[model samples]
Target: MGMTIALDAMGGDRAPGIVVDGAALALRERPDLRFLLIGDRARIEPLLVRHRRLSAAVELVHTSEAVAADAKPSLALRQGRQSSMRLAIDAVKDGRAAAAVSAGNTGALMAMSKFVLKTLPGIDRPAIAAVVPARRRPVVMLDLGANVDCTAQHLFEFAVMGEAYARAALGVDRPSVGLLNVGTEDIKGHEAVRDAAALIRDSGLGIDYRGFVEGTDIPEGTVDVVVTDGFTGNVALKVAEGAVRLMASSLGDAFRASLRAKLGYLFVSPALRALRQRFDPRLYNGAMFVGLAGIVVKSHGGTDAIGFSHAIGSAVRLVEEGTNDRITAEMRKIASPGPQLVAASS
Candidate 1:
């Protein structure tokens, strides 16, 4: 069957418009794909009606709920039952969709996903996974925010699942893995890091535990997989993304001020375009919440049509590769007890 992406049209900061436009773009580009944009028909029908080219390509699902970006997670999930996030995920859980994508509040989506689809067997919690461009293959970082407070054993489990992600997504043989830490040295991290390192060190799971890595290493594209608790990992991911935008914007403002600089920019404009594409958050939007029973992707909150297209494209690839099914089997394989933690957080 052709892959279908269920998008939460009312989820992002720019609702139906950006979501709908992106779906239209994807539908136009990929002839083998279809999208079910979940939102309010009353609000979206006119938007669709105006675009004859897009009107025929997209289908709308009337979602009566709204989960504002800053709303409390608990309240958002409880009150926003008709939310596009919930409805879109429902499409996946009920087999109406192969995968679902959203740009809603992270915590709220995580909470609702647990409630609607639940986790795979032997998987304690779902970890958000992001694909970061690297020198070789894209590095996949997990636990972006599914579990803020995690145990040492949980971190080890993350490594296992992360490896599965790299294998399924990156096609690496034994995806080199490492734990994000305060320092790259062996004695750098908290108890959880030390414990996870030991567990993976002697693991018979055929994974390459490549020691420790730092925040700077993320942009350097040094590791195939970087594992950390959501609290720490998420901060690093945001900081890195913000840094890219800050530097790019700063450089843009600098080069546009002078005639000499403007002339110089023309010479390097092509290079700059290449670099911008590499750092574009749109290119990074298709992050999966690993350990879940089905595929769920989270896109940037501020994404427009361009970014949304990329996210939907990613959902198609994930579904085609059967990534979630492979991840679930991996979690079941290492369900046994591993090394013990010495009462510490990573």
Candidate 2:
């Protein structure tokens, strides 16, 4: 028997259609996978007819309601009980699926997953972790818009979860972890970061803890995992993404500036194409809500079928790799009596 994943089929910018199409794409790659697609029967059924294999592998659960793109997290939580997004998460909570994937409202998805799945034993809050392109390899950064404000202990927990994530999802063995800050110096950041660093260092968690890393270090691949509060992580993510867009745009304009430049593009086109592929946002669509008891992947809302398929792929890997198990085991180590985590002074 294969692992089943619950999909919020009515949840994206282009609902039902892209959801079904993405599932079809994912099914081709992982034949053993099964799906519990939750959405409107009328819209989803027509798309399924085109992919007989997927239709066979899927069990559709009908729901006409869906959380709006702009819906507040609290409103969605209170009123979206019958929404496809909520129902799909419900499947995970009810043991009907091994994981849940959504291209829905980010806040709503995070809110619902936390409410339904709860956090792992040692975790106070679940953090949203995603892979970002780096110089050497992709880095896993967490607390991505999940909790804007966090305590030192919370950041410490994020490091533990992030290290486990790198090992499970990125195939990194003994991944190096870092606390994001203004400077590499221990005294530079606010008390929370300094304390989190101290906790990770003294806790004897066996994590390869790199003291501090700046925002520039993220793209430079200074560490395998970057841990921060959601507010900073979210801001850094947007800044990096915006920078990539700006660079791409500038390159395009330069290439079209003159006939000479256009001719020059022919020679660099292959290399540029390779670079584009390496940094394509679609390739890194899935953001895992780490620390949750059950797997939940949030796909980019505007992503196409290919991107959504990658998000599904992320869910498959997380389940197959037993990411939560790794987290639990690591957390247990900290809970044991060897070296207690030091409390940071407020």
Q: What's model 1's overall lDDT?
A: 0.81
All candidates: CA RMSD in angstroms?
A: 4.7, 3.0
- Candidate 1 TM-score, C-alpha based: 0.89
Instruction: Please give the CA lDDT of all the candidate structures.
Output: 0.81, 0.93
Candidate 1 per-residue lDDT, tens place, 1-346, comes to: 3577888988788887888888778877886677787888888887786666666655678877778899898998789878888889989999988889998788888888888888878777778888887666578897887788988778887887888777766767778888998897888878888888988876667778888988877777688899999999888888877877798889999999999999999999999898877766776676778778888888888888898888888777777777677766666656654545323432
Per the 3 Å backbone cut-off, how many clashing residue pairs does candidate 1 have? 0
Reference-based TM-score, model 2: 0.96
lDDT top scorer: 2
* lDDT tens readout by residue for model 2, 1-346: 8999999999889987889999999999999999999999999998888999999999999989999999999999999999999999999999999999999999999898888889999899999999999998999999898889999999999999999888877888899999999999878899999999999998877899988999999999989999999999999999999988998999899999999999999999999999899999989889999999999999999999999999999999999888999999988887866523344322
Output the number of the TM-score-best candidate.
2
RMSD of 1: 4.7
TM-score for all models, in order of appearance: 0.89, 0.96
Worst 10 residues of 2 by lDDT: 337-346
